[model samples]
Target: MAEQAYTVVSDSETTGEEKTSSSFPEIAIGIDIGTSQCSVAVWSGSQVELVRNTRNRKLMKSYVTFKDEVPAGGVSDELAHEYDMLSGAAIFNMKRLIGRVDTDPVVHASKSLPFLVETLNIGVRPFIAALVNNMWRSTTPEEVLAIFLVELRAMAEVKLKRPVRNVVLTVPVSFSRFQLTRIERACAMAGLHVLRLMPEPTAVALLYAQQQQQSGHENMGSGSEKIALIFNMGAGYCDVAITATAGGVSQIKALAGSTVGGEDLLQNLMHHLLPNMDDLFSSHGIEEIKRMGLLRVATQNAIHLLSFDESVPIDVDLGNGTKLSKVLTRTELEEVNKEVFEKCEALIKRCLQAAKLEAEDVHDVIIVGGCSYVPKVRNIVMSICKRQELYSGMNPLEAAVRGAALEGAVASGISDPFGNLDLLTIQATPLSIGIQADGGDFVPVIHQNTTTPVRKEQIFTTVHDDQAEALILVYEGDEKAAEHNHLLGYFKIRGIPPAQKGVPEISVCMDIDASNVLRVFAGVIVHGTQRAPMPFMEVRMPTVDDGHGWSAQALHKMYGSTLDLVTVKKIQHRDC
Candidate 1:
């Protein structure tokens, strides 16, 4: 293929930032920031191509080593051995730890890793630290992720020979809007603008849709619809999505995901091998950290080898005069991590159930991710789906990033002659979003599975007579009680005319645009007036702080029902 050149154009109407003419085009790359690995790719005019790092490798380890005063990600500098990665200087798995409070179980599990994770279970961000030069240097997950992204951006810039700025990143489907905010914040810290945060499975769905369009008949109708079950399991997360595709349009039907992944499996096998592994390497001394690293490397190798062989031999000598030797059989490894495999199966079943489809209805069972190559995982998924073969057209390791690159091109307003970029994925709301009403109940305005780029509203009224204000406490979940769900943000609508309880009509509107940014608008209108008595106040959702759990409780305790709202029948028709 000949080298293709693009023109850089700036829209002053979009960001209100001035754009200067450049020698090269500004191309937005697709980034798959995985739990254990990360990769970057771009639409190379003709096709999506992976950008190699300085080492000429596509997939780079997702970690940053703070051995020196200035931290460096593993992408540019390779560690000598597996033990060096666990030397208390390298921090990995920031994907799982990001956006989680200290009270989260996932944060607690991270404490088992070689790095230092201090938690208080008080709804604050955890303190993550890496040992550097005989001292523990504190850092945040956001900072670590930013460092890693900076390395990725540098690599892409060098490979593409352009100033890369915008990106389309793939995120887990289970990530809440608040979590999505944190990811964006990290991207900003790395000096990059996120064009879109596409769900990982949905990206794969887009790739599937493009492939079908390329091979389908000329006719475009409902008869050509194809249902695909995408199962994505990586190092730190497992996500399943069911999508319906036809004529290059893919509609997501259902999504299910969890934090269980290869990390959990490795920990389980480590314990099974030594049995007293925790006690053996409980201390954070240099020697103890080295021992932990050695054991981790041995365990990881055994797991990888088990995929192709029946059993593997593991032997390693701890610097502390401890000799470890064992033989791990495939059956024993599976037994040790049965729960992880079971969770994968449950996710697939739940997703299919929610989509109102059966395994037989699925035309293709696509598996993608680092862990998809595992024999046991493949067997369990194939058995559950009752399929004889897995989809083998796309590369398991590169599909997500490639799909993201395609989205980047389309979202950047780039056109292709081959029609590859002429694709769309109709996304759905992964969770219900609503406000607190009916005395602490979660009143959903936008239910789960609702199509995206949507607008919804629900009528609410003051709970007390002569009320002047109403609180809009937004939440995201399917739970009945507001407290049980994840609080996105909240705002207050004041200046209501004095009226009897449940007399004034207040409307709360939730708007999610194409990029999944949410905005909440609240206003009050009198019974006989078409115009709102008070001007509607629009505030972006997830305005709550990082420690939002406590904020919700504090708000309720400080002003108990003083500004609460109750659901009321819609009497006035107004455009939202």
Candidate 2:
């Protein structure tokens, strides 16, 4: 085989020492790290199976309570009441808050939650605190997620009867590179190696691909391709994807997602039932927190009830002599969350448009997520796809995790003669990735929906004569202006010999490996000298943090082309 272009390092395994073993450990388990809940699974010899926690629960609430000095996850330590979960001691929804800046509207919405979320909106990390012993103990979203993952790891280790080290995680399609880095950081903190970070819907597609492959053996159209539209809406996110499957290969055609989900629905219904409810429970006092928790539980129950019944009665005491009584109908609930449903429909339309396919072309419409059980959600998805029924072969709740487990097995080189684990998912880049060039224009090196394990390079020239450095601001989005896109990170390329403007050729290369790790390499060349054998510098991406938007603006205003580059004439190449 040809020499590898780069070295692979598991983010969590960086001790600078290698351990040899006669046999490798079992394949990494698959984990679905959710906004409101989590699950772990593995290939249990015969098939993929969900691993239950100590409580014998397949799904664990994704919350970390810091009441004690040693934090406890909801999986093993059960809270006495739902109020205890929101008593300012537990931190949930970290998935939504991770890698987000104080300026994000989502962060502002999170302030209304039980935990304390403080923001300055100046491109810095938000200050989050949990009530412990009546004192606010500050913590980062990364810390909260690490704590929960530790609990998950321990549970998996005990049940599997081995030390679990590696895992395949499922993430939202809209997560930027910076957000992905935050996830890897959390996994590192938990002492678990990340084998792969699969997109949520793509994982479902993998499971679907396996199912189609098995059934095709007995059907007439065994070799024909199948098109599927996957709609996944959970507590924290909404994502849609279209995929084409044939044999064992799953090709992702298009993807669209948003930060709307069951949490938004719950908040909307809570506000509708009691206007100014957030203001009512703004105080973090014990009584106020309990009251807020009570309202949240009631709202959650009402939303769930509306899924089964047409109307649900809600009566609660605000703990300050305020009695709120109301009966909410399914129609009213749908009306309250009209925007969310509209966004979901818009996402589907966007995906189909991107895939260049009509609704009639979809052979299967698969729905998965906690909110998939909601009749309204199902109805809207069915109406958009114009399908009389949904693909009911997979379980809505466990499909993603099960798919992840199968991925773990396949990625680990596990195989069977029966073809039970013969699967491959050709994931595509969910967003455009490029560097800022040509006076702050977003020049895409790899467009959205491009297959992964991809590399693309572009040549650029210095804007000013004798410029010795160039700043590469990597961004993810399709905006014309770099400022409008999500800034993944930035680095300066140096060691360029002095030359006239546009004389020295600077090549910037972006590589996304199989495990979704991104690396950027830059090199320089002169007309009279040979090309550099190695890149001048290579940096991992998503180094930007919260307030990246402001950071981009500041860089442009302060530098003003002092260290900028413009696109140069390119050579012939194949389409990406």
Candidate 3:
């Protein structure tokens, strides 16, 4: 095995300005880069149209193969056989690994993939590699994603006969703000500028809104508000959203997401068939890699078959005197992945509760995504919403990308004569953004499911006597404990002027604009004064990057609550 050098386009060499079509009428494209598949669509003057590759396939496998001297992605690369993709040379599931630390459970789960995923169990980026020329070639998730995006861009350019620059991408709601930066970085690396990143369910809500508006116009009736419960479960994530739709507006009332999906189901069944699967693949020899790939292909085929059949047979012959034979029933498959189904149900219920809506209030129950084909997944969503059927207006696989295409047109200022372009999707925060206070407790200023383009503030007081400075540790998540959540960044509010504990007032404000940018402001005022002692500080969120987990622990170890602050009460402010 020998090390090989590969040259990639660096982002520093590119222009810093986000390329827009302000000079010319260019429509941004919509792309849905899923864990297993990817698609690109755009508005073709009058309506949204899906773009097809040279192979005439609309959905391309999301992977990058390094078997050749030059890396190739699924967008243009064609394999002789499906087994070739699982031969340790193709890297898939980059979506699950992007922006995740080594200590993340999701990163740990990704170790089972054919490619090399090495983690030190520390809060840092995991090491990923693909087999090329009999040597393990190192790569980052962001780099692999960028390579794939470049291919997608090339294909779109060839088809549309125009330069593809601006794009609207759809991401899972569970993605953190730091994770979003990774996505933007990948786009930048590919020389593409992202106009917007809509949550998967919210994009679907936009498409639904347009449908409802058309229906209202046809009936010549008032465009009444319709409450929709949307459940989206793809290969790597599951998301739930409750939206209020009227006319052409889709106002997202609540959003909940989790890292549970089809991948978990496949892995569970693979392990069920071979209990010693992990132990067998630990060596990573050529024979072992082949054996693992064989088992994976057989298991994947069985799962897809189970979607339409009562039972599917999985048979694979792994060389070195190993063989597997099993008849997998649909019920057995559901039982094996019981936790996945339960999580999907829980997300929907949690979203409904957050929106303060009952199951009866849902006028339409929509299920979309790759896993929506599974009987158990569909049943769980329908049963939770107490509906006999799901809304079948859009394709399960193409709904998200289609909605993204609609958004690209709308954001690009394209107008349709039939009012199809008159639409908007008002998004909400998918996770609560707050600070650590009251001894490691998470006190949220902007709670989850709160409408975005919002500004809210909370008042706090010093926790210790004679405290002149207070540390504001920003975090994001729904956890009650601050340490369990994702740390976005931190700052200090000083010049409090010597004061007794719980006397001085500290105003911490959080603002989210229409573009989904987050800015945190902190200021302090003395006990007997109406004005602050120092100027207010405002910092954009997600300042911390890799090793954020370690940073949070180190911050606690160094300060040890010396600069802690406790909650006083909410501040009365107008939320816009």
Candidate 4:
């Protein structure tokens, strides 16, 4: 590469404040705030530039400190990769608390955190986890999130030198609307506007497909069809999606997610440490584990070993001559985690059924996310999927964030999404969908697993004489009774003279539009007219860390981290 001599072409027309595209920043960043670690990537026109936060050092600790000087100190302006040996402080796994209600199963499970928990006890033991609280003030989970958001925003701001705002946050598919709302609020509090809420698996497909298509190797697989199964296993969740490929266009066919992630598995191991080890959260013990790099590296190594060979050694630092370190065979790992694996298998099976395809129908099976690094999980999936081929070895931990960056790029016009589409098949039911009867009975117009972007209609007569209006209830799900399923909303038709019952010729129609929003319309003979409203949807789980009298069983993991904002035009993963 030779350096070319630059001759400044002094054109008098070119003046002082030149407004060129280069002067403006075209970077889009994706933040994958996982339970174990947090990652973000910037799309710098060429490719995704991924980096781990040196301030937080690891992805995320999911612990929040109240009024602690530690979490609120010395983050250098420069990107220095130093582990925050900050003790007497709290910060870890905020992802678990992103969007949650008082009654999510995961929330209850957070009780064993070893940190002092506080907050209301709405049946969830740990209302919230706070390390330090000002005498009169306790930190809200939203405030805890404020810290993580500040850290992430700082990274983007430092790199861009401009305020970074818009973002596409990915969440678990199982997240409910209420949960999503809390997360969105968190993001809002952090000054970042959520452009869209994408599911974990979908993000992976978008990232993988974007790379494949951009490299001019779009059609790299057989059947001359473009499709991939994104198997995303992570620290706190697992997501599987059947993404179709068209010129790198991705659409989610069927998606399945679970709160049971690699971190959960690690946490289980940590429980094993509880028996063998006693020095977990001592004044300097946790820091010592971190300083020795044993906490992070050992955790990953333990996970890796258990997933591979028959067993591996477990080291627990039991101060004063009681060294607790022993080999744990893979068999023992499986024996201890049989139920978790079984649950994962069941979830995957359900996803397959939803896709209406056999395991063999999958074109490409790619594994992403941090957890899939476990060999057994991959092996079992291959066996169950009955597939001979699988792809791994990519940076699974950051793949989702990278792909998210690409999506952000496409949204920013820096690159075209080209339907490079991170295809997410909306989970709409019934092909010729219709609602239920008033008597708590089911009216099946369409069935589940029916490919959507569809339209269907049904006619109903006015129930009463002189009836000028009629209302119809809209619903979703596979229950035999109308009340059992989720009510999508309602359809109302106004304007008809009061007539005999069943006299008004009223009709109702349902449409799943391009953006996956469901539309409900009603019509009556008023110069022959019809009107309708739109349908809705995405991520996060919140946790309560305080020792509230509330029990997790009552809530059963009903945390509201994911919400349906599809119907609402202005969408944001607030407080996310």
The lDDT values for all models are 0.85, 0.85, 0.88, 0.55
* All candidates: CA RMSD (Å): 5.3, 5.2, 3.3, 11.4
- Model 2 deviation from native, Cα RMSD in Å: 5.2
In model 2, the clashing pairs are 123-547
Lowest lDDT block of 10, candidate 1: 1-10
- Give model 2's clash tally: 1
Where does the lowest 10-residue lDDT sum fall in candidate 4? 560-569
lDDT of 4 by residue, 1-576 (tens): 000111112333222223353465445578776665566777765567775455545344444443434344122322211233233244455566545444555665554343433325453324443334323223455555555666677767776665566687777765543345556666766666676566777777787666666554535443245667777777777777776765556666777666787766765665555543333443333444342233434555777876557667777553444455777777666666777787778777887887878887886788877767677688768887888778653577777777777777766656433434332333322212345443344454445535566676565555446655444545554567654443444434556556666555555566665434456665653333533322211101122233222322222134221110011122376677
lDDT of 2 by residue, 1-576 (tens): 111111133444533222433254467799999999899999988788899987798998988887766777777865543756658888889999998888889988887678788888887789998889999888877888888888888899899887777799999998988888888888877877788888899999999998988877653346588999999999999999999998877899998888999999999988898888778777767777777788888899999998999998999987778777988899999999999999999999999999999999999999999999899899999999998999999999899999899999998888867887878999899999998989879988888988889999888889888888889888998889987789988888886777899887888889999878888888786565665534567888878766787788788888778999888866678575
Q: Give Cα distance to truth, residue 10, candidate 2, Å.
A: 14
- Candidate 1, TM-score vs. the true structure? 0.91
Per-prediction backbone clash count: 0, 1, 0, 85
Per-model TM values vs. the true structure: 0.91, 0.91, 0.94, 0.68
Q: Which pairs clash in the backbone of model 3?
A: none
| Candidate with best TM-score | 3
Stronger candidate by TM-score (1 vs 3): 3
**What does candidate 3's lDDT look like per residue over 1-576, in tens digits?**
121122234444433323443465678999999999999999998888999998999999998887666778898655533665557888889998899899999998887787788889878899898877778888888888988898999999899987777899999999999899989888877878899999999999999998888877642346578999999999999999999998889999999999988999999988889989999988776667777778878888999999999998877898778888778899889998988888888999899999999999999999999999999998888888898989989999999999999999999888899888889989999999999999999999999988989999999999989898899999999899999998999999988877789988898999999889999999985445466689988999999988899899899989999999999965578585
Candidate 3 regions exceeding 4 Å error are: 1-24, 78-81, 218-221, 526-531, 569-576
